[model samples]
Target: MNGASLATGQRSLGDPSVTFPLWPPQLRGCPETSTAEIAYPVEVDYAYEDVDTALFAQAPGPDLARWAPLLPPLHAPTLGEGGTPLLELDGLPGVYLKDESRNPTWSHKDRLNRVTVSAAVGAGAPGVVVASSGNHGASAAAYAARAGLPAIVLASAEAPPAVQSFVRAYGAKVLTMPAEDRWPLMRRIKVLTMPAEDRWPLMRRIVDRFGYHPVSNLTVTHTGHPFGAEGYKTIAYELFAQLGRVPAAVFTPTGYAEMLYGVWKGFAELRRLGVAETAPPMYACEPAVGAPHARALATGTPAAIVELGPTGAYGIACTVGGHRGVRAVRDSGGEAVPVTDDELRAAQELLARQGLWQELSGAAGLAGYRRLGREFDGPVVCVGTSSGFKDLETGRERVRLLEDVDVDVSLDDLLRATDA
Candidate 1:
């Protein structure tokens, strides 16, 4: 079957009857609810068929559009976002690294933006708006620019300087505000309401008033963008093609778990298409502080929100966990693994020694695996989602210059100074 063989639509994760078209700007929340504050999870649906293996086996093209058959319609511009290398560490026999830092914006968010911006284009929106602590804003701004649309980013004042610079570099209008104030501004450009007590009301305003497409989660529970996660499916396809089959385990760094869910769905689709016999167990790795997914799994709930503690791995320190992540972990017999900042830092250092400078949060998968300390039956893959350059702590080291070098110093004296 070709790319056009499938029809894409949206279905509410909480209520099946509450459905809408994914292309046009649809209801941000379930229409059945009287409370505008109630946000529901929504997902994209597509018709399935047995297609030839060649569809995935083909050498991956530069952009995410290469997997058009499985993704939403391509209504936006391309920036060579996909086809990142699957690297192996010499010391780790069964472990492989899905290095996603190679994406256009140097993070996995590029994959998400490629599809979400396309959604904006499909709906004929003038521009895009997003609320991100870092990588998401940078990717959205870059993709929106590529799609010939103005971009607006609502970022926290606490956002890393590098990420703020990246967003501005893409020419997106960057508004630094209190985290609570971001969602309200997302609704009406002029109406910057006092920080609302909840997130859902402002989410509705963002769609109903601003006519701007949202690339990230708006729900109290993170349903994520129906089209955005489709971009991450390419990572699964690439892994299968590169490994010749699905690995035994796939470890992913989880915040809202959008990428984790997407990767699991991609592998499930592969199995459905008879491309592989079974999908791997997915591990959702998170910072030790506020691991909502872990709490949700333990409590037998679809989603949960937990109290957060301080963590240097800010990118993945999400307080709220999504149903998508819980489902992926449950269905695959996977577990939520929470790692300390120290563990993640060590993992990042390990990657750096291997010539892969990954963000501390992005090294979570390896940290999880190290915590697991079990022998896998076959190959295991850990996703490294971004570059170390994006981390707030990443910077040049300070070194002491031994006394200012004297012009009269001899070569032997210089050698002695160096030894000293």
Candidate 2:
């Protein structure tokens, strides 16, 4: 009946204060309790009603302004990652394409970095660093610049030049390093930069203390600010709002599985708040070369930390599992499907027919959907996570709009001859 209660759209059982950590602890495996108490720097007051609205809104949960102040003003990018058109594929039962190439950074990674940079700003770091093969680096750099924060992206020299160019364009410092050096450096950065206690106060005063902000490495799954994943929740929220119901399944291309975790968590929150009747089963589509999620799923484990193999779909290429990946698969009752490069290329062609352009890894969801579409009932949405331009260093073949031809004579000569 009160104003705050009306906005929340729920009655509070009681007002309670609780301690929260700087970051949500990663879900290792199936636990006795469905939710884990996360640790943030400060204590927050929570009510049943607060969780209710956060669950159902057409956005991800958590307040980014509170959690990540170093970010630029949060606004919807016009390119449209959040409200993607869910189109039904012809002859594919209940299959839908959730195209993400339209995003500002031309990838779904934009959603994650937007949240991650906010956290970096909140943490009072001088700059953020990341180890990325491509899309993640581009997005991280883009958001870092927007927040007026410095960024350093470590990438392999062998990576596509176009990807490298994107990082530079955003004015992020690019560090070309070997794969062995990337993770070790990232871990060191997190330890040195993050405050041991009182993370909220440090984060809150980021802008005020320093006119120019800097954030540390963004590659850490656990270290990333909570608000980063919140951006991805918007995907699910919009899907639910637009469709007027939850889909039967959602298939995503998994690297660290952050995107998958956000969507799954969003739906779970909705279901918990009585907004959604059920949660969709989440399916992860990874390259066959390094299918960590698939291996973990096969063993019924939360994640399989293994060495990564070589692959062209470098964006979703990672050896170990993040906390989100484990939780996403287990909580959704979903599985990971390994897809080959050939299969992804074919999916890309399929999307091209529908006028949706996507990168190779982005096509993995479509590949999985093609294989699993028969089993799923009702609606099935597969996310295309990036644009082809990110990997153009190999050089995509040019498409000719016209063929070479010659005219026998000029217009005046033809007219004179015809008249005569």
Model 1 score (lDDT) = 0.81
Q: Assess each prediction's global lDDT (C-alpha) against the native.
A: 0.81, 0.61
Instruction: Name the best candidate (by TM-score).
Output: 1
- Per-prediction tally of clashes: 0, 19
What lDDT does candidate 2 reach at residue 44?
16
Which residue pairs come into collision in candidate 1?
none
Q: Whose lDDT is greatest here?
A: 1
**Cα lDDT, model 1, residue 403:** 81
Q: Taking the tens digit of each residue's C-alpha lDDT, what string does model 1 give over 306-418?
A: 88899989889887788778988999999999999999999999999999989999999999999999788999999999998889776544544678899898999887876
Q: What TM-score does structure 2 among the candidates reach? A: 0.72
TM-score of each: 0.88, 0.72
